[model samples]
Target: MSGPAAALSASPAGTGPDQVRGPVITGWSAVSPYGIGRDAFVQGVSSGRATVSVLDTERWPGPDELACLVPDFDVREVLGKKGTRSMDRVSGLAVTAVRELIAESEGAGLPAGGEEVALVLGTTTGSAQSMMDITRDTLIHEKPFYIDPSHIPNALMNCAAGQCAIWYGLKGPNTTVAGGRASGLLALNYARRLLTAGRAHTILCGAAEEYSPARSWLERHTRHPDENATVLGEGCAVLRLQPPGTHPHPLAELLCITTAITHPHHITTTLAHTIKRALHQTRLNPHDIWAVSPSTPPGTTADHERHALDLIFTDHTPHHIPAPGPIGDTAAATATFQITTLLSHHQQHPQPPNRIALITAIDRDGVLATALLRLL
Candidate 1:
């Protein structure tokens, strides 16, 4: 996540009139490997302690691998056993994170019911374990529709957001973005659009990933063999976003979000362009950015991202923070963590008002996203 930078091309041409304002993040919640709450996450990352540990070899047999997995997280304890009996790990994480977010913002001008709020979540892949089980049942079982009825709901990529809506009563609109590592930014941008368009007054936007034996196996085969590649991690984080002027004291104001899709080989250039476009759209100079949170995956992708950053901030050296180093690569959850980490850093350091931060993420599919935020 932290590395040398690069510059993007010329500023994005102005789109002229009728541009909508960005959304403001009023509240946020995180469930990470560090612990069950945002405070645990901030303390762990700020203290600079390593959170990565080896998964149980017997249960996750494979090469010696490291990961940042949530410790002793049981959904039954939080959501109770009845409904959770069918909830998969990812869905449970999403539900818990959303609950925490709404709880924390009880009287902070949030929507009163499900019809007033929308949910948009991101993911790399949906519930790998449940998908595997469903596939296995389809292949091995002798009868049609032999898969467990309990597993069906969890198999979809949109299950987390759908389940969150069900559990929290969020009924305005629900969406799922499969943007891989860039999922968080994609979801944020979508939520912002919803707010800007007056489609919803408030929205829950974030990302989640689960560390399971099935996911580990997929990574072992698909991920490159570079030592710098990050260990896999799992967690869910959600931000409660509202239109500007709606919340009296927002944590931060989201200024702009930009994304670009390209071929996989063009990740570096596309990412640089996306960041440049976001800054251009926000009308901010690179020097105006006080800090940068980059979602760097392992291997050549990391190198490409570092190079892109080096190019972007050639004049001033912004604080380069790597979101994945402490928590490992959390797939779709990486960018949400990055945004939260930026907020957390400001909370501890108390930066001057109106300072800006930039967050960027790139997925394996060559989806590049950049979000510009201004702290108040």
Candidate 2:
């Protein structure tokens, strides 16, 4: 993440470590097939759109023609070549989106001078495309170790997070996460807990993933394509969690974040349970939530992913398919987009009281992460 100094209120009055509420997501940006920034996302969701082109169809090992491409974004505008070369497109997306997020609200998502900054990320596949490149060198070209050793660092799961820390000059706790699509929500929950527990005052927390060439090959070979409905898309969401307070452009107050895993058939029940548990944790009522940013399915579960989700939390308003659905890509982008949408709802219309925004994601691994965001 880049931009102005965002300072969290250190030792706010009347709040100790246990009393400290979870992080309030000040701002965020998403780079997806829908395009760059939040404006494109709102448009896509407004139209009920999805990317149509065949995914990774080429046998020659390269990116697919059709993707939810972010419109008009160049790294050079934000970083010099020296800094940009170390990052892959996926990591570039991860860092740039966070930078835009930080730009919206200066220095709130990060620590001021002398404060600790932790890096926690969630991703299903680290940089599988890089790995695929190396494998291609060996198999397709019969060239052993033909890949660049410099590019080998991104092959690990935590490489993205580590590189982000180095690139951004953050020197605090750092880690990576992989829980399938649930990685994003889990990352947020974990970061929130760390701040609450006083492990670190601030964090650059998010996840990164991409539809790699390897994923495409695997899907083509897999007998059951439906099993891989979750698209192999790459995106990341970085939220600077600070003790609860009024942020100038807060999409919503991240009241509570929680997760669970259940059978695919019982997803609705598990989702409801997670929502209930979050509410119980925060002492919130169903009617308090004005809208929900629910997850969209990629044909894995029944087409009734929304119906199944609504059956659990039918009392609240569910209008748009919030967040990731707008982009038609999978990963933590859903949760991050959900959070951004929740905050945007309140940002657009001020004084939206009790404007609780709920974000829920059902992952392929049967993991359900439900986050409660309040626009207080």
Candidate 3:
């Protein structure tokens, strides 16, 4: 068998949650092209081989030749009939990822009416298609009377966060963060606070984005391949944040997470500052970082962020695995992949450096968000 298949072939019990040390990951799931779960994603990024794959030509065409979107999985298998109707693709991806995380955490068996749990969700675009669909219906169908109000709820960017809290029955500190791509990293940091204050014992934190035709249409004209920028893609990433000693055999710890906003010109420098801030907050050095997981094709202003790494550290990143390389860009999913990359690196080698896993992004609208995350 291959890497991930080999890993999955083993019983989850041998290395499942309920078995590790402090600040454990407890649970995690990714809706990416590399497959679901951290192990599958790590296998693709570490495979060290090149492959070209077609992505969304029929429905959502983009300039890029390929993308790492989730394939071969059905939402119905994981989500039942009643729950599926309330979600948009973005929400679907997120909740699906969260389902896996919960299963891994054994939260799937959460006691009935366990209102102590809560969910903090994040997203750059919650239901782009819902908005587009309404517009198309109004223009083509020529009747506002037939417009569906159900999509109105799904159309909002915060719907993913709200839908998750409703479905999971979690009633804790439910905050929907808005930090552009850094939202995923910030979401985890937000959950950590709930645990710290004893406000919630386990917080489900995540980010999600759905594919949009308009976004793809714009990419064809605006994106630069040489610079490695692409269009919006669909996916979600979820992590279960728990108190330091709640579970064992859990993966990595959430050392700290922080965010910063700056002018587009200062992308790299700003990211460096935020990364150092994360290290400072955790009291560590840059060299101690074993890896830096930034998304590939670092958009215009954000390109400097990667170049800045060269200036700061002599060691080329152990693996320049830009997350979206194995799992197309889902905006917020960038931070999700960042978290997975960090945990994957740790699982491969014991005693990973108390390093900062950095993420930076600048959107076409000129908004930039930079964040740093580390294991505790």
Local error of candidate 1 at 315, Å?
1.9
**Model 1 alpha-carbon miss at residue 230, Å:** 3.6
TM-score of each: 0.91, 0.79, 0.79
Best-to-worst lDDT order: 1, 2, 3
Score each candidate by Cα lDDT: 0.81, 0.62, 0.61
Once fitted onto the true fold, the runs of candidate 1 whose alpha carbons sit more than 4 angstroms away are: 1-21, 58-65, 227-229
Better of 1 and 3 by TM-score: 1
Tell me, by TM-score, which candidate is best: 1
Candidate 1 weakest lDDT stretch, 10 residues: 1-10
lDDT of 3 by residue, 159-261 (tens): 8777777777667767777766667766766766666556766677888766656555545665566445553456777877655446544455555555666
Candidate number that wins on lDDT, 1 or 2: 1
Residue 86, model 3: Cα distance from true site in angstroms: 6.0
Candidate 3 yields a Cα-based lDDT of 0.61
Which digits, one per residue and each the tens of the lDDT, describe model 2 over residues 238-309?
Answer: 666655543444444557777887887777677777888777777766766666777664665434356655
* Candidate 2 worst ten-residue window by lDDT: 1-10
